[model samples]
Target: MDANFAFLRLPDPRLYRRSNLTFSLLFLIKFGVKSFKFNTRLKMQEKLVAAKYEISRAVKADLAAITRIYNASVLEQNATATLRPVSIEEREAWFDAHEAANRPIYVLREICDANLTSEDGETFEADCERKFDSKGANLGAQKPSVTNPKGEILAWGSLSDYHPREGYRITAKISVYVAPEARGKGLGGRLVNFILENAPKFGVKNIVALIFSSNAASLNLFAKFGFARWGELPEVCDMGGKIESLTILGKKLG
Candidate 1:
């Protein structure tokens, strides 16, 4: 991905929380039951969904690009609450902190022109390349270790620190971002599903996602993963423009 694509605006945390919620859900019993169903096997399919995007850990080499993408999210006034842009130095610090704590940073990349199959007749990614050439698919050939060929990364999702308490160690805050070009492709759904399925390996018992009240895409993504609202702040942030509300969405892991 080219970091030079300045058109991709980052999240403006303050403005987002204050924006009127495009949609609202009352704290009703029916709503609760429907939400709970996703966590149970009774409605597991509804809990996890995805587009054709690929998910993988962020390699050290991916830091520059990862930083670029994240910063893009930061620039969007609606995506985050923070008014300041994230810096690479801070990202490196985050890397060090996660490494020391054994946490992980994930990256979703569009598979490059890549052939990713063991089949010899033709390249796997090459076939995919022909199929989605217009869409600019990342054939998954760049990372030979990650099997299964696919088109380029349309979006990515992640698990951030949950909280600062010991009991809460089994929890994580999740975030998903799809390239603006890749929205509506189900990539966010796919990334969230992959993360939820693997949450337990990291000892996660709860999955949390902090979103601006106006962020419909993120809210829907969490809902797709069976996450429900646990807390709400009427207006926790004050961006230069206005104040915004915050909603915390969470799901029990096991």
Candidate 2:
């Protein structure tokens, strides 16, 4: 008998049956895991295609949401060097500085109408209509109406002055952060593209991204946009005693 089939011709037929059953069960488990992962990836891709989004300049109302997202990253310590969660007051100051310098902060919001339903089973538009009918000549009294109104904020990006020196005015550092639950769905890529497209409008001739060397996702995202590795600072950040290096990636705008 062939060596491969020797196990099938075991002295005890019961042993052969047990071994075959175990082999079959192991194969099914491995195959099932692979299938499950593939199906999950497919569903994510489908959701990405079906979802709608709106990207606009950040406003004061968005500051709190923006701060929350950034603070989450601060706690993770994987994307940013900040060791502690920052206060909303600190972020407000940062937002004011960006506004004053004409360095815009952009936010990406998912657009959906599902959240507009009221507890009374009326849609937002319907509720607005009822209020408008009851209050004559006061269209403004009704709740503000928007076409495909804003949903939860998914991500935000900004271009800040790379350096305060006069000569460095043409250069800007780029930063992007995505909500933990909304990641892996291409939201970050959308924000990056939007930022790059608008960088020149803000007088940005060169764009740089300062990312932790261990952040492979960020490095790959920037690399897709033609950003090249410009420099590296070895062991520059100490995140809770775990030394981390910093990688500087840059791209020149036409």
Candidate 3:
């Protein structure tokens, strides 16, 4: 009876070892499934982050933001030929003239990122504030006091009618302007490319860009899209104090 009791008190090594092995295998399987799911979710998020912007037609409500982006280029003096900033009201007529079928003004807006949310899990609105003059003074009612924080316009591209004549109906000119803070982010290239791909749908057989000779960035941007120098005018633009030459670049599409 004492021998039997001693044998019962001894541990069952085989049974215990089998139980431990089963637990370890279960844990590894669970961990592998969770890690695979996490990796898959991370890859999907990366794809979403790649498309951080959108392009759409400029509505009446977008004129203020568009004007601000345009004025930013004006202040830079490297992109546009304008020496002074344009007023919103002054651009109202120009905005109204862009018809969807003939001339379209497309605005590129930034999509709010998930990481930019507040602690309360609410997304923050982008600051679309217009810049003040060199004197650091905001002009009269021309400026918008409140701007939409969501979907802020980062750049704008337009296809304007090249001529009002009947014979030149198939010709159109392109213009792209990026916000001061948003430059060098490939926004201009994206906007211009959007216009090029969609221009043919609007009966545009030829697209032209009138760029300043000194603007190598703009020239290169157009050239990347197969635009060639068709003509040039020397000393055509008087930029306040200095006169600049203009280059004519065009692309003929099928």
User: Would you estimate the TM-scores of all the predictions?
Assistant: 0.64, 0.68, 0.68
**Model 1 ranges with Cα > 4 A deviation:** 1-53, 113-154
Flag the better candidate by lDDT, 1 or 2.
Answer: 2
Which has the higher lDDT value, candidate number 1 or candidate number 3? 3
lDDT of 2 by residue, 1-254 (tens): 58878667438788899999999999999999778666655444344334657899998888887998898899889998889999888898999999999999999876533224333333332212212225342111112246324656668999999998889999999999987756887889999999999899988899999999999999999999999999999999999999999999999999
| Cα lDDT tens digits for candidate 1, 79-160 | 7765777777777887787766656666676554332332222222222222333666532223334442333344556676
* Model 1: lDDT to the true structure: 0.64
Give the candidate order by descending lDDT: 2, 3, 1
* lDDT pick, better of 2 and 3: 2
Error of 1 at 216 (Å): 1.3
Give candidates' CA RMSD values in order. 25.6, 16.6, 8.2
Where is the poorest 10-residue window by lDDT in model 1? 42-51
Global fold similarity of model 1 (TM-score)? 0.64
lDDT of every model, 2 decimals: 0.64, 0.80, 0.78
Kindly give the number of clashing pairs for every candidate: 33, 0, 1
